[model samples]
Target: MNVAHFEGAGAPPRKRPWTAPGALVVRALGNAAAAAPVEGAMLRFGRGRPGDPGKPVDVTVGVDDTKVSRQHGLLVHRSGWWHLSNTGRLPIEVGNHVLQPNGDAVPLRAGVTSALISTADRRHLVELCVNGSEGASPAPAFGLHTAPGHVWRLDERERLVLAVLGQEYLRNNPRAQPLARHQAAAQLAELRPGEDWDVRKMDRVVEAVRLRLSGQGVFGLVQSDLPQPIGNLLSHNLLTELAVTTSSLTSADLMRLEGAD
Candidate 1:
């Protein structure tokens, strides 16, 4: 069971496969009292029905329903165990995968659980053997590729957030040229909902970009709120000199002449 965010209300539906290579088959015991009925559906990765003669249940993951953030994939296992894996820059613990067994909903193992590991054997998924320019053969269960080209269009807020990333880049590298106007604008459009894209976050985010580019930059709101981890993510996301410069600055800063104190 892959946790995919589907825009079910006719919003460019992602193609669903009958079966995927790494898809996990899960068993749902019962509904959680705390859990509300949510939208978005789970599809098996490969090509067969989950013919477990238990519960014909559904598992879902998305912003509107599960509130699972930043995780690339989620699987509720056959033994009623849940596993969340990172698609981006974070990881979910094994304890975080526990289902609500017995009493009020509780995490699995109560913090004694192991880390989330792939159950797939070497056959289901194989690393590509790169043989010079000729490349290698495809693996048996090729999964949904989240390539950059697969990016859904960015909304206005997301674009602004992206712009903030650009601004951070510009603040540190004063000599760099500006970002492509259209590119910056498009990125701002793709903000995840309710993101403020505020100044303090923007400042450190900018500094984070600088640090990644030159291996050094600023952090924190006044050195106190300096978020080292988030800064690192920002750095990884914004590497180019142009992405660094414009993503770091605000409109107010932009109004001032470059190098003006």
Candidate 2:
């Protein structure tokens, strides 16, 4: 018996047909859509009407989201090469790049390589060979540029997602507290209340609890202040942190700390 495999069977064969060396063309659809500057939408809901002038001109990468509006400003010199600053209420994600060109739609040619970001998980997925384009369809905002270097257009939703995720990330990160216990408790209480109001009483209550749990490592569950789900998450997170500290620190290390001592 004889078996044979085709030349491109083991791997995707390259098929570059009049394609640019390292360029990507993305359609202004999904969350990436935005209205053109003048007669354009603040958000690209979907589909555009005919005879719309001052359409979101094709923009290049490197433009900031905040500066995308007031085109006359960012477009300082290049009149033909339009620019966009992310103006949407959304966050400026370091990832997530899209390409949408005007006039003509071009599919990624066979053997061409590019990365598409998953709108759901925010992960890179799908390396394709022989991707096709239906040609430039009407898009509120689109981009034509090289692959994976800079991003220009960022929509509002995209910005929001990034902001929320970033805040969550920072919330989870641990930090060392150089401040004394009294000073640290004062700061934490301040974050929850107003300067004009009476915060000292509240601070005292927290300090009492902080003292009781100082060495035992059990911060009493104060169910009165937390929403059920948030409380659960907070408790889970705090306990996890405590477990790590318990495992990593020696009794001497805990004793050396002024307050814990």
Cα RMSDs of all predictions? 18.8, 21.5
Q: On residues 116-157, what C-alpha lDDT tens digit does candidate 2 reach at each position? A: 322333422222222224222222334755545322222432
- Ten-residue stretch with the least lDDT total in model 1: 28-37
Tens digits of per-residue lDDT for model 1 on 1-261?
Answer: 233322221111213221222222221121110111122223221111123333222322222322232232332222332223233222222221212212122112111123322322311110111111222222234576664422223344333444444454435442233354444433333343245434555555455434444443322212232222232333333433233323333444333323333
lDDT of each: 0.29, 0.27
Give TM per candidate: 0.19, 0.19
TM-score between model 2 and native: 0.19
Q: Candidate 1, residue 140: CA error in Å?
A: 16
Error of 2 at 259 (Å): 14
Segments in model 1 whose C-alpha atoms lie over 4 Å from true places: 1-38, 44-49, 54-261
Residue 117's lDDT in candidate 2: 25
